[model samples]
Target: MSTSTAPDAKTVRQVRPALRAGRFSTVLRVPALVTIAVMVALLLVLFALDIAIGDFRIPIGRVLDVLGGGGTRAQRFVILDSRLPRALTAVVVGAALGLAGAITQSILHNPLASPDLLGITAGASVGAVAVIVGAGGGAATGTLALVGVPLAALAAGLATALAIYLMAWGKNTAGGSGVMAFRLVLVGIGVNAALMAVVSWLITRASLPDASMAQHWLTGSLNKADWSTLIPAAVGLGVTLLVAAASARTLAALRFGADTTRMLGVKIQTQQGILLATAVMASALATAAVGPLAFVGLAAPQIARRLLRTPGEPVIASALVGAIAVLGADLVSRTMFPIDLPVGVVTAAVGGPFLIYLLVRTNRKATL
Candidate 1:
């Protein structure tokens, strides 16, 4: 009886992994795919609406015709040259922000831990403004001008992240690690405030045209979208998404506390660096493309987790959600107003209320 039981226990251990694997595939993986599909379908619809409903209101058929190089020159101009880039910008930037938000929230293990909160976006903003103000009001001329804005933004964002990490690292009096997360958030807030002040001063010092350009960029307009912005954004989105997917397992392990993850033989700091770098690049490039669009990064990941009912950060789902939110907001901003509004304004109006609700609910739960 003892021998038989021993064999049975060994078999159970073997079977358990198989069961969990099957469960993961069925439960989490399949649902995520389905969510992505649904999001893609919704995006297609929104993209069509956005491209088709301008002053002329081109039909979907004609839009497709222009896309296929079969439409008249005027139709082609409306669909291809003008609307296509802006719509693509919304999708690319949104997806990037969504992915960035998901990674940051997961690693920090805080709902409020996002790029905007962590000063990354503010850093990008500062970089952009400096370029704008320095270049006699941000005109896109001279050598290396085309790539300067985004590169500066990216470098500044990375620098901000590094600064936060360094500032947050402190040894306790007992010579042990103190509370890193709390320190990170606190430092980030301070940095963000300083950066914003710098941006304001720079704008004030710029020439009228340059100041106007700076202000428009700060508002986060898709109206300024062109092939130049769109192409780089698309490439960045693809690269970041791939890197995020590659780092997903490490990201998931981070939820188990650092010691346990370390015991599992993962190089914790290396993985964290990869994830942090990816998040910063994603957010920074997106900001460079569309200015610092707020709340999308803070809101998209949480929304995706809720939508997917996942314990882990749903990076793909979050990306889809971000894209949908941006695309939808862009449509509303352009159409549902007396004049076109900035996409950031629309997101802020919606996200501000959502954030308030989150705070209230969190407080209520804590009190209860």
Candidate 2:
């Protein structure tokens, strides 16, 4: 591929000045902060609504008292035990998925690079299902399933990512970023399909009890949430997100082009390693917590980027936007009809069309 610009320069376009710094700078920080703050407030209001709109109504003051550990016993039991866990779970899982999507897309340089798009969720489901079918929900069994499932998913995903990345790099390591993006997404589709086939096979072999359990988990319900689940996710998310945020500037330069980034003093191998590790951990941890809800990462960052309209990755906006996406999808699932649909169904329904639109837009722009 010959690259030429301005009549004679060929073979490698210079990185644009705007994307060179690897940071958001003044242009991005202000609106990003405002968007993030609004998302938090909106989420809090939605959470309160989630608390209030349950089977019964509780006064806002009373809900606060209940949460603060000084309310009527029944009130305490209802709000403290029920809604709070689920709401907080939504926030954490949403953040994880959002961050996961951002880093995956940034690292691979593809808007469509989501865990669900790449089959990480399916891989996680397969692990979760094998546990359900083979191990019968004993304490040890649940523990092992919880531990084993996401690890398997992460391992499978990382393996798949590495394989695609390596194969793409072999053709021409120097200009492989765009090619890597294409290869990863295409191979991810195949990997995801293969993983789904395995999951189906497991479903076929499962005993009735196992089949039921696996089926429920796959539907992506938040009913299983608790502090036990929330704490681990929070810790995992906190660590991985910090790493990703710290790498924000590096990621910006990355989008400019790797060689440009390297010229600008970014350590290519190290940054890529950390980025992949962070993306994988954020994704694996979220998958462990909630069984993969389809489009938290993909939708959140895209939403944030559209709103922010700045150069480079919308890391912070993406996180806040992720929370909104998850909460919004869950709200729809909860109140869309008499029977609450699975959260995954809501996300899939919303994300699928949105994704098609993005693909078409990219295709048109490419042709233009």
User: Which tens-of-lDDT digit does each residue in 74-161 have in candidate 2?
Assistant: 8887888887887787788888888778877877778888877876666666666666677764321445645665566556556655
> Which candidate leads in lDDT?
1
Task: Name model 2 segments beyond 4 Å from true.
Answer: 1-29, 137-142, 145-160, 173-179
Candidate 1 TM-score over all chains jointly: 0.89
Whole-model alpha-carbon lDDT for candidate 1: 0.84
Model 1 alpha-carbon drift over 4 Å, by segment: 1-29, 141-145, 172-179, 365-368
Worst 10 residues of 1 by lDDT: 14-23
Q: After superposition, how far is residue 122 of candidate 1 from its true place, in Å?
A: 0.4
lDDT of each: 0.84, 0.72
